[model samples]
Target chain A: MSAQSEFDREIALDAADGEPGTYRGQLGEGWRIGGGINGGLLLALAGHALRRELGETSADGIPGHSDPMAISAYYLTPGVPGAVTVRTDTVRRGRAVSTGQASLVQEDETGREVERVRVLATYGDLAAVDGDATTTATPPQLPDPEACVSAAQAPPQFLKHATLLERLDLRLDPATTGWAVGKPSGNGVIRGWFRMADGREPDPLLLLLAVDALPPVAFELGLPGWTPTLELTAHVRCRPAPGWLRVNLTSRTLSGGYLEEDAEVWDSEGRLVALSRQLARATSPRR
Target chain B: MSAQSEFDREIALDAADGEPGTYRGQLGEGWRIGGGINGGLLLALAGHALRRELGETSADGIPGHSDPMAISAYYLTPGVPGAVTVRTDTVRRGRAVSTGQASLVQEDETGREVERVRVLATYGDLAAVDGDATTTATPPQLPDPEACVSAAQAPPQFLKHATLLERLDLRLDPATTGWAVGKPSGNGVIRGWFRMADGREPDPLLLLLAVDALPPVAFELGLPGWTPTLELTAHVRCRPAPGWLRVNLTSRTLSGGYLEEDAEVWDSEGRLVALSRQLARATSPRR
Candidate 1:
């Protein structure tokens, strides 16, 4: 099987085909070196496809936005080589919390199963922050999008050793903010306007994964050999009518080869949508 | 209104005492000032106290030993000084996870409540590790007890701080070896051997709070100035037999004025019995 482009290939939701308690996924061989399909990516894709049956628009339809996700993914297996298929099923859904199981599968020319995973999720209404019934958008003010080149404008770095995030394409409204660097294939803590990079009107879930691609704004403070995220727990703040979203990202605390990053994502209305904290393991690129 | 040395104070275990439906704590003022607590203390207080309730013996039950527990304490509140009373309630007791809620409270002279802390804990089964079921007592192969001066031997930075710890009379076995630094009353991460500075053994419950006296190993790698913690979730691998347990500790990561330190506590038999992880706001002594 070959996957040359997103439009050129087609697959249905794995839940329709597989039963509960079972999973399948591809362990991409060339997916990682510096960049590849890591935990965040897999989680996004699986969560996205699983939404239709849940009576909610994909995490994208939740309104306002940049990655205002209150979810996290735990990496149990590395992305290996090959085309991957993700299967998901509802594990439990309550008024405030719900869980889903996802499995990644890979097959050789003969269609053999490779790697798989099952995830449990818990989500809540972000509308209750600081006693506010609906999430309020009073975030610290940031410069306009046209005034700077956001990390969104940078070409995403897709590592050959791992799964590359080829699905994202970003743009900076200002296209030339001074402090922003690496407009092309931006690397080492992205600074920019962000989006699906595919020109799709912003979706919260898509934004969630996109933000994960960039380093936290705090990282721009200049910490080196940065590696972050063994786990991530995000708090969703506000939701607004969607439009261009801009954010500044930086990295810090490059010590012990392990680090954590915090992000503040806002909406077009300047409302705070979500905040994420990620921890990652530092790995030197194999020369 | 004044708190004298009311050491013999005891409070009945009222199962239904405390405000329900409220989820938060008043972190002690001192633990937030960069350095506070060690894992060995946490283990003794937590593990020993729990064991004692389950019909275990005192510190005198163990003979030759050296178990240094370098652990993590994610600070939720500053300390609650004065005739402190703690209440520990078991939440869940599964084979894989044993959960408990411990609250330390202090009442003002007028009997007004001043501080309260709730710690949710997980004590993993020792069988989870590749070790024997019953704890062994093989002393660590190190110098004789006459060779090294225990951390308790070091001059107390605050002569007054020593008074509180000195009353406990915690003596250490020589085989315990590790590196640690001291923390001022209001600055920096501290580490080193930790036991009751007083030669007398203490009730295991009171002993756990002493770990808050050492510097969190995480602050070593935090940002210049900041300490933030909304919650603390800790896991202890096994239970150390009560006695003078020694722990080798180090400050691990400090970034964004926030730090995280993961520690391990091992007994004289080279068996790992406890571990902890703490998240702190990364802050400099003075900006």
Candidate 2:
């Protein structure tokens, strides 16, 4: 058998023997952003649980409601690398789509279980979706992967405490990396190409993580502290083609200590695969 | 006491005497578009319930976590104008923010209660939010409300079955209202000025309703059938100044029988007050 990809192994969930909608998993290391695990990774964990609970064939002989069409997650606390529990609840089951909710919980130092993230998702069969395909948004222009600067090779200051960068091959658009050297573009935009280091093909589930893999857009605006996501919503439009995924993240408005970052993920086939928007706390640059 | 505005009377909720976290409210008339209630109004119902549940003073003496910062809702079934029961669950209460979930339920013709919408929201005090304010987005430009075409006086065909227009003073940009006639601009953009007919001021909760008030962006794309929103997420940034709020809605892509519409609501002071994104079914233009 082929070796399992790091992402697959990290997000793998074991269903509880007696619990119909409960699963257990582990928060693997090497995915921490500052003092906690990445928000996207945490969301992917909940998404996986929701998929497992809602992907079953309906009693009415209906099938193919496996892919997550829309998912939203609210981050309550930062996740740490440890054993975690995910409890799923089927909100509604219909012929075409089913909705489910999942909560990721972890045991704190005091032995109390604390909720890390709560997610709500709707599942449907992407293959059954057929109709008009129109787009006014195009893939962001960027140099080829080889020409872009590898995030792994970014300045030491930029790579500090971001172990998650080691697990993915992220190539940032050179133009937007000015913040690494104390020269921010002040444009509040970040574009990059993302793929698993092991070259695992992208799927609807993984797109949840891909949408938030890039650095916070506030970096380009000269604000460099860790921006914690408060809430994030992702819409998986279609299955992505195999290859590098182009990502563009932009922050349009920052008010009241919060910023809304919108991301668009495009596949190598130039198809728009997923779109996401997140609300996060905006922090000022460190002195 | 001053007379209650129609909006205030319509959205008023009565606490369930025995249920700690339950409230009942009517869906109200004149808010129907097609055969179902507007998604925004349904969301507002749920938001009101969450506010009542989470707006209490914390035991830790933390004050001002009342306004909803981010809220997401999944539309499970079409909401008809009737009595709705909202049940809220407090997910977590923190010093700075509190998260809660609410589900709107109503009885169907069969006498079985049906869940219409499920919402998850994070609440915080908008008044206490202070820090660096930065924005790359500016309010969309549009002709004065007097120069624009009032939706109430729109073409008869365009005003058909839309009683909600009579409650809100909506003036659409003349350039983008071509869709009302058979000449769509084909730009998938809608800009307008929005205000309650009774001169009610926009609040964090009302902004939820205002964000989804405009016509579907698909209409400008020459596809004019009813677009049912599958999921929607709105972030209320701050309180608005009393005046006609400018709203701009845009659709960037339509694929797999779905499209994402993003809306930005700017107050009279030109400060962005709320932002929303929704995924909806895209329908073909009726021949």
Candidate 3:
């Protein structure tokens, strides 16, 4: 596939480090491999690995894909100074889906094992994963992200910090009153429109990433800006290669400390492209 | 606090990526931009992010201290080619614990906007998440991983595939086969003892990653290898820092094309370190 070259050009270039390579990238700056590279950077690197594997590569002449819904990692050995190596392989592949695994390591200067990792990835047909495809109806009618007000729009004075809600383009279903994270998105939601500007206007990809970002609930209770989605699995039909994909996401908080959220991403005209579901450990500060 | 310097010295001054002045770490030769990195690496990165924000450095922090019970990720735009950036911050760092958030992205040629990612993370007095952290009382007696029939001994047909289980050093409590995966675990062990290698060898971090490696079973069909995880979550507690970790996983195959598994992890000494729960969309070609 044409994408293979793109994948190789992007990830392979930096594909060295265990002890030698330095953690690269901006988000990686926040991480302090010893002092700064953070967890978010590690995840981005992992995602980079995935894209490289799938970008131009396909299994059995078919592109192997996985809409990751959840992920868990253990920072075993910190990325040490020196040569680093990423070891990857297809754990298992199937007719509809495939799983790939990778490990990031900082070479051991003294011949000792440094860090290790194991991944469980799954790929499949879109129908089973996308609620939008299964939704026998249309998405709920709602205001545009531009016309909506921030639900958590109280003063920072009343709280302690700023949240993504403050940085997001939000719209709520009038029917939600605010409990709208997981209510039925009405009829066919042909599009999901989410835009997060990281300086200049956000691009379509950024918008999609933000739209497909962790559920709003994930950021609800923690400090100012904290929403970490360990893994993501999105299911789509005739997956869109849209110029601008708009996603309408909603979530439901369960009684136990669990929360379930689903999002329907669409093209501008109201054509549902995919469905995404996520589970998060919901926490609220004890008053 | 001293750990910070330890962490800093570990990854600082590494080689500048070919991009010049940037650090590079290999994930795999084939993975990169727009291609998603491996899930395990992403999680590790996220863990590193959380630790950085929590002011915990070194493996001693974040992934170093977690007993992961659950995790979820949302894949945004495919990772971009070349250096991705990641940003992480603490969500709620409370007395016994707190939560953190991480964001991963790839820079554009302009290095302006981030390409993708936002993660939600939680950290607490691990016990808090598992409300059931009381000690389990019994005459300590578990089926030695060595004594158990190796998945290798199963059959030639099942040989190649069980590579994962073969390396597992599963320790099942004799009174209840709680920590086993795939099969043979008996008793009302809502959970059981599981590990990749069966012995005194210690590899806690790798085991933490292993916890997420299990297939998300849709139904309790005793098929060969076809469990698709829809979602998974883990609540952590306390346990061995740099040693073997035990997984006590058990699942109930729901009739409606779904299955739910509950798992708990422990240290070699039997201290409860984490609790896990998961749901899966089970399907297969055989049964």
How does chain A of candidate 2 score by TM-score against the true chain A? 0.96
Which candidate number would show the highest TM-score if scored against the true structure?
A: 2
Q: Which 10 consecutive residues of model 3 chain A have the lowest summed lDDT?
A: A25-34
TM-score (chain A only) for the predictions, listed in order: 0.62, 0.96, 0.52
Quote model 1's TM-score for chain B: 0.51
Compute DockQ for each candidate against the true complex: 0.03, 0.66, 0.04
Ranking by DockQ: 2, 3, 1
lDDT of each: 0.38, 0.88, 0.40
**Fnat by candidate, in order:** 0.00, 0.79, 0.02
Ranking by TM-score: 2, 1, 3
Q: What DockQ would you assign to candidate 1?
A: 0.03
Candidate 1 vs candidate 3, lDDT winner: 3
TM-score of model number 3: 0.39
Ranking by lDDT: 2, 3, 1
**Model 3, docking class:** incorrect
Cα lDDT of model 2 by residue, B1-287, tens digit? 12398777777899999998999988876898755898998888888889888998867776636798999999999898888899999999988799999999999999999999999999998985442358878899999999998888766765666778888999999999888887888899999999999888888888999999888888888878889898999999888888989999999788878889999999998888899999998765544
Candidate 3, A1-287: lDDT as tens digits: 22243212222335435533123322211113212233323433554554445433453577555443333333333443344455555544445444454555554557765543223333444335322322233544657665554435434432233233334444443433232333323221222245332222322112224334433433332222222333333433333443434556554223235444446565544555544444433454323
Model 1: residue B111 alpha-carbon error in angstroms? 41
Model 3: residues with Cα > 4 Å off, grouped in runs: A1-24, A28-45, A56-90, A93-96, A102-120, A123-138, A150-192, A196-208, A211-215, A218-238, A241-287, B1-68, B71-287
User: So what's the TM-score on candidate 2?
Assistant: 0.96
